[model samples]
Target: MHVDLTRDSVAMGDDVDAPHRQSLHLTDDASLGDAVSAVLARPYLAQIGGGKATWLVVVDGTVSAVVAQQWAGPRWLADARVRAPGAIHFRYLAQRDPGEVYVEYSRCQGQP
Candidate 1:
């Protein structure tokens, strides 16, 4: 299987540069769901491929699936608000609340 990661990345200046493109290879998995999940999980892709990737094109032989990102990810990974053009989507993975992933830096460990 082949997947294309298209990045409409963000910048501080808010410039609209052309989208970046990268490709991926899969061994056995052939489901549309699986391809989307792999893109969401940021697996095996180069930094430019997965991070900030706003689109995904999954090519399985003659079948091609195009997906878009509705919003930016919490992290730098290429995941958030992903949707296919004509597909019924249930939440792939329910994300945890901010509190669940928060990190506290002021822990008391005494003298090291």
Candidate 2:
């Protein structure tokens, strides 16, 4: 599966003061697990001081899942909820108080 990351798309939440949205482009062949790991590995997400980051995952120009990562304490956490072609979400939590959180996802080459 191949995932593309871009800052081009924006989705506004109910709050008028909410930040602009970002999105992740996923190929039809992309797996949610792989895509989530790629986003979590971004260096910008490793910054200190807790904040929320979200990305709308789109497949073939259609929104498929919403991935979010947040940190506020000793752990950095992320999750993805798929809304197309399936219904599922995965949770990732790592201790981040004294070290970095490493994200790695592995799957069979022919599997999705």
Candidate 3:
């Protein structure tokens, strides 16, 4: 199932005072291929679309990568450690190769 970006909201926690967060939503039904593409598309998700958004990748309840948008992209590789802020981390689990991610936007200066 594809994650309903329209129905979902990205936040730090369930607290009303939690730091407001932006998210790059991917459908739960989205295939692994698509998820990988989305990440790569927005190498700097926080800077591009997801404002303070966390890349929440999960498969079978096992969390995959929890990377910050600013530090995520197509460069992620298996066993690779692409770092960003202390709060972000990317994990490449699916089978894929480099130069596989692509993203475009008319404006990238605001939150998505």
- Which candidate tops lDDT? 2
- Could you give candidate 1's per-residue lDDT for residues 1-112 as a string of tens digits? 5656554334433235334455645544454455455665763222332322222232322113222233333221222243332221211112223222222101211111
Give all TM-scores, in the order shown.
0.32, 0.33, 0.29
Give residue 59's error in model 3 in angstroms: 1.2
Tens digits of lDDT, candidate 2, 6-112: 33212233225232233555666555555655565654233223444443334444433334455322122222333222322222232322222222111121112
For 1-112, candidate 3 gives per-residue lDDT tens digits of 3322211223334235333233545554554446555545753332323343334333333333334444444322222322111122233222222222212111221112
Candidate models: Cα lDDT each = 0.34, 0.36, 0.33
Pairs in steric clash, model 3: 1-28, 1-29, 2-27, 2-28, 2-29, 3-26, 3-27, 3-28, 41-102, 45-69
